[model samples]
Target: MTRCRLCGSTALTSVVDLGATPPCESFLAEDQLDLPEPAYPLHLRVCADCWLAQLPPLIAPEETFREYAYFSSYSTSWVEHARTFVEGAVERLGLGADAFVVEVASNDGYLLRHVVDRGIRCLGVEPSVNVGAVAREAGVPTLTAFLSPETGAAVRGEHGPADLVVANNVYAHIPDVTGFTRGLRALVADDGWVSVEVQHLLTLIEENQYDTIYHEHFQYYTVASAARALASGGLTLVDVELLPTHGGSLRLWARPEGAAGEPTARVAEVLDREKAAGLQELSGYTEFSARVAKVRRDLLRFLVEAAERGETVVGYGAPGKGNTLLNHCGIRPDLLAYTVDRNPYKHGRYTPGTRIPILPPERIAADRPDYVLVLPWNLRTELVEQLSFVHEWGGRLVFPIPELSIVEVTS
Candidate 1:
């Protein structure tokens, strides 16, 4: 029996099936055109015991993130987001020369750059070789290995326990959830705080964000489920904040039980809201699958209509979520033409399942396609501003999630 990753519950129900799909960032080369892509079961399940939403087991972390393709510094908005997060966290924690900060899965030192700038000692534990090299170039000392109980203990032995341990958007990606949390407990000092940012399950269902379900994201979290998971490893949630990044996310602050800091009203309020919404009930899982089906049908119909009208459609932002959405919808190059990405690594490669070629953003301006499908719909505002010149050709930007809407630009 496949037990729940969090609560060890054997009672689980399937929620949504995204079918077999390649890892979102598994871009292909021209020589690899004929190679069969490795597709895994993209099924989500809810733990009846703890109510944690999660994907079925598939690719291991070593296979998925050992040579990560994503670079956090590619997006201008994301860079600003990291900067703001660092500034706020440092101020909130009163971190200075005496404090040491450790960040897990710190891709390219995006957030740690600010910590180092403040003259505070910081260490980054990143598994991806290429990304860790970038972090090293940025002057952030990064260890190239997965963060687990053993690695965490080694880190603590060398650098001592951290005052602040930041793990932004890494909680959902870990498959061995129990071992990972235990690693956090081993690394965090008695009074230190471990802050984790994860895409909120409540927001994922409410916003119809099924595209976030790829092989790398092993677990989806609600504040209640997160608290339960942490408590199992001897930690307690002290505070929680709802963030707007990646559609919607939650920043959870945790520490050892009875160490310091009391659970904030926000934590209790969020947990209460999740319980009232039936997150812990089986009915919630059944309803979520139906909602996802509606989204698939709606998106397909919109793309078909556009194709019939001879509207030149192209995709913006070759993000992982975009890959999942396109692959699930069975969209290919005939409909999307090509996708634009700011990351150099993704450029000149083809998206996994669809095989849509990825090019630089300049292609959009040059081609001036009639319809630009904004794949990374979460960055609509920033993308619209950057590609506003498409208005010169009377082109419109199409957003295809939650609903399909075309926004016309007025110059």
Candidate 2:
């Protein structure tokens, strides 16, 4: 943390300090609940030199990813998003049966399963053994290993160079940006395309999405910083697309420097937007800490008032972002009661640090709480439709991000 992870500079400015919290995904089992739990610093800082917003690499990737609790297939919209991305990639890249696609950190083969259906050869390089096994079970060929320079070279040597390397929602997970980018270079063909999707820092700041900040996410990237990260491994960003997934994200298209032509005008357009939003300067981040504080205050006010009024408030979705929100707000089982999730893996566990019990999705309907706090607010539209039945018992849904609002659902 002394020097920027992306750039070796000491000029780092504080973006926001979220105090300390356990790894968002570290759900505790009932047996381990009595034991002491550990928490790490959740502060995010921006490098004045490179402008990459980052946290210190307090936890290693293996600690989080080796036996990950998150399964991408649980989210209906995310699965569809992956399917759409695969179809578009096939058409956009002119990929056919001969084409080879490799996805890094390919959790549960969410995206590559579509590639498999199309008869395009694909492989998922995933670190988590449990989730990778699920991918293999689904008939998506997966290799259980972390993406390093050697790992990428080995994959390339065994299966030949990849025609397309898709890395979605993982660019920010790795602590060593330079080494991870080089691993990407080693896997992709010289002229092949590399697509990376990461949460956009501009939207994160503007939308008051501080809950997304956690130890698992080592860094946050704007287009300017992302382009620099891509260049470190000799990849040139050729195009950029703004995506709605994960609140707001950037879909960056890159390739080897030799094959990468001039970047699309969209790249410049987003860069201009980032500059306007003060992401490249200090002004944009100045009010962020205050705004984040306001969110924490507003949420706490609602929860405490609801408790006083004898109204039950429970949470929905035990996502990593939800853990961050819960821990940062200092919410325990008393305020939240319990949260329900679609993922069976988290059904009987407790959220890290906050110790909120995670029950099955059906628990929400069985108990019929007064208010269901939607933690994974990024999937707002999809979750709204899924939880529409809440209107049955006059139950309402709550969204915390982009400001706290309680929605009256019409079934």
Best by lDDT: 2
Provide the TM-score for each candidate, comma-separated: 0.97, 0.99
Q: lDDT tens string, model 2, 1-411?
A: 799988899999999999999999999999999999999999999999889999999999989999999999998899999999998999999998899999999999988999999999999999999999999999999999999999999999999999999999999999999999999999999999999999999999999999999998999999999999999988999999999998999999999999999999999999999999998888879899999999999999999999999999999999999988998899988889999998999989999998889999898889989999999999999989999999999999999999999999987
Clashes, model 1:
0
Which runs of model 1 end up more than 4 angstroms from their true locations? none
Off by over 4 Å in 2: none
Q: Residue 80 in model 1: shift from native, Å? A: 1.4
lDDT (10s digit) by residue, model 1, range 25-51: 889988898998888889898888888
lDDT for 168 (candidate 2): 95
Please give the lDDT score at residue 375 for candidate 2: 95
The best candidate in terms of TM-score: 2
> Relative to the true structure, how large is the alpha-carbon lDDT of every model?
0.88, 0.95
